[model samples]
Target chain A: MPTIRVSANGEAALETRDVRVRYGNNEAIKGITMEIPRKRVVALIGPSGCGKSTLLRCFNRMNDLVPSAAVTGEVLFHGENLYADHVDPVEVRRRIGMVFQKPNPFPKSIYDNVAFGPRLYGRPPDLDDIVERSLRQAALWDEVKDRMNDNALGLSGGQQQRLCIARALAVTPEILLMDEPASALDPIASAKIEELIQQLVEHYTIVIVTHNMQQAARVSHYTAYLYIGELIEYDDTNTIFTAPHEKHTEDYVTGRFG
Target chain B: MSPADSARASRHFDQELQELRELLLRMASRAEEQVRNALAAVKQRDAQAAQRSIDRDGEIDALELEIEERTINLLARRQPMAGDLRTLVMTLKISTDIERVGDHAVNIAQCAKRLAEALPVPDVGDLDRMAEVSTGMLRDAIAAFIDRDAELARDVCQRDDQVDRYNDSVFRGMLSEMTRYPGAIVAALQMMLVARNLERIADLATNLGEDVIYIVEARTVKHHAGEVVSDVETEGEFDQ
Candidate 1:
């Protein structure tokens, strides 16, 4: 295994050293080393089952919930090894939050949903202020500020996703991991999410996994191309979209491959 | 094939790209021929041949419009990236350049027709050489574009200085002829106009060359010629 090149500048908020993930007999992620820059959006893109999602999961110890799954190698957060003994996985997840492929908002009111994480974890003082600030950070405050008591499920698909983002923000994470955040929404809604991602990146480091290369090009500052569980290429978004070094990456981005 | 490659390759978009390339090549070939014939018309002082160049300008204009429409259609619909995106954008820009090249040919033809109608001046041999070099530059630039040859495009850019030198020589020669022979003044000025048009043609060809370099190498060598340094090119770490 070799050190994967991360060409972009700035200190890496999250770093992976030869990280590999395996589920039972199947090796899903090969040894991959990456330096994800702080306060920047890095998008992981590849074809289905290429380990983009698996690698993204490793950033926050999301793979720990799976049985028979083993992740070797170190995932470091700002120079601290996350896999060290006594480092709680729950705390790791709380610090590094995730938004899934679909908008999985709770059945409760929008305000309650944003407050849920805080109440369960630290029960931060001034719960109302926290909820308001989270909603504002997620760009959902103006739309649902009056309807804070409304059920989150009653909101539009795009709004529900934003509410989910607000919920994720309620915990006040340092880094945000989004897996196909806008894949389930309409083009207009997807554009909104993309805009939100751009703004939120100023406050938190973001790592997104996306199948849409154009969206990756649009929203991310950096892009990583993965193929068959192996890290193929990682570079700035402009380079990956315009002139990728790897033949596999070129083929994938140009629609020469699936 | 890899499993993903075997899945679905979007063959329709690939075919569209192929068709667009061919159409742009055809347009370039037509423009190139018009340039050659128009320069020949100037050397021969043949109004009939000059008229042919004038007649074809509308066709080139229509072709330009068609290429623009198709390019916009592909960009809006396919949402291309990487090499495909560069190709389509350069096609749109190169077509505009070629169409303007066509217009320059027409301007040369107009001068040729006026020179044919006026009293004759001594032929300036350098204008013929300048015509040959500029037309050849146009041909090679289009060739580099269609073939995706960045080096060939750079060669075209390097030749622009030569055309500029010939233009300077042609201007001095025509000015001397105008000063010497009072009766040949009108024809000398027409010849000068023809030389000016040829020089502009060379500049457009240089534009085509710079665009081809972008299409082929993903490099912007527009104002600065030779080696273009970008973030991707300078970052040695990502070379692996």
Candidate 2:
């Protein structure tokens, strides 16, 4: 009966209330309340400086790493406030993983890359199983199972991106935030990342920020359209793409302007 | 060469477009009025007037075909998008419905001609009401298309059920009258056919109304049951 009930999963995988992020001289994100269900992909789309990326970073306190960044909001996961007084920012990040706009695989072997996160936090008795499962979940196990010992830097850009996803999954985060994860790759590789994000929705709540409106339409079940640091409209992907209610939203989706 | 001359040139182009729209409106209104007058002739049992109505329906047919050709040419030449596409599509659909309206008018006129020889004129109050409502539906539906009014289009769709109800009553009345008087069978059958034809005209008007809605809202309410009322968010986590 709640106004924004997303699933019967007994808990919202991620929920934000009055979330705002500010820089020293200007505000990057205005107040935004959004709910993403467990195991679903929600795409955030807008023009440059629309604060989609700023809002994406708020999920795991990535904004905190910024020197002048200030945040005032409640971002909850599984009914508990992530920024509560006693919650560790480091532990919060481990629970909610992130991928960047460009692939940032560490300078290490592919095997060591996927194994790094699990090696850091996973139970030692199950390390090998964890690494294999994570790589397979990222859809990279078959390609890299033979070259597990090869350097990640030698992998193609797309492969390296998937390796980064494997690295994130290795830690087994409940939520994965990807900031334009396919912007650097070719269309084919971008499509692969999109397909992997869709597949990942079975086990992890995924939030994506992208300038590609069609990509957002293809990958997300729900879409939030932002403009000028404000959430203009949020609706099912099909409705937003084909029959948006707001004129502004329609103009943006139809390529009237950025 | 002068600033005033340049202003006059821009005004000429604007006037040309306005005149184009005016011509299209004249065509649409002519087709709409023919539908109303043809139905009126049938309900009044005025064979002379019905013949006149039927004869005039050729103009509507000619206009419908002309409009369709214009719409096709507009697509080829202008390649319109967005609202222009909607307007062009509405014109195409409205003209087809207008053609069907003309056909129904011809049917009613033929029925009036046959009934004049066979029977004393029967009271056709319900038939008159059906014609009135149906003609109004057509008029309003065309107006909606011209104005791009979604609300008026929806109202026309709702009014069709009323017209249909009157048509059914006319059919039932004629059926019982024929049963009561064996000699009246031929005339009653003609009336029945006329009523069915008018019902068909109303149905075409409904089609135009629904098409207008599609042009405006991009939603097909036809064959769609009930009102779509709410948006419910499913369980999920969205990072705001």
Best prediction by TM-score: 1
Instruction: Give the residue spans of candidate 1 off by over 4 A.
Output: A1-10, A147-150, B1-9, B226-240
Worst 10 residues of 2 chain A by lDDT: A1-10
Clashes of 1: 0
**CAPRI tier for the interface of model 1:** medium
Candidate 2 B-chain TM-score: 0.80
Cα lDDT tens digits for candidate 2, B67-179: 77767876575444334455577677767777777777788788877777777435443777777787788788778877878898888877766766676687777777777
Classified by CAPRI criteria, candidate 2 counts as incorrect
List TM-scores for all candidates, in order.
Answer: 0.92, 0.71
TM-score of 2: 0.71
Top model by DockQ, which number?
A: 1
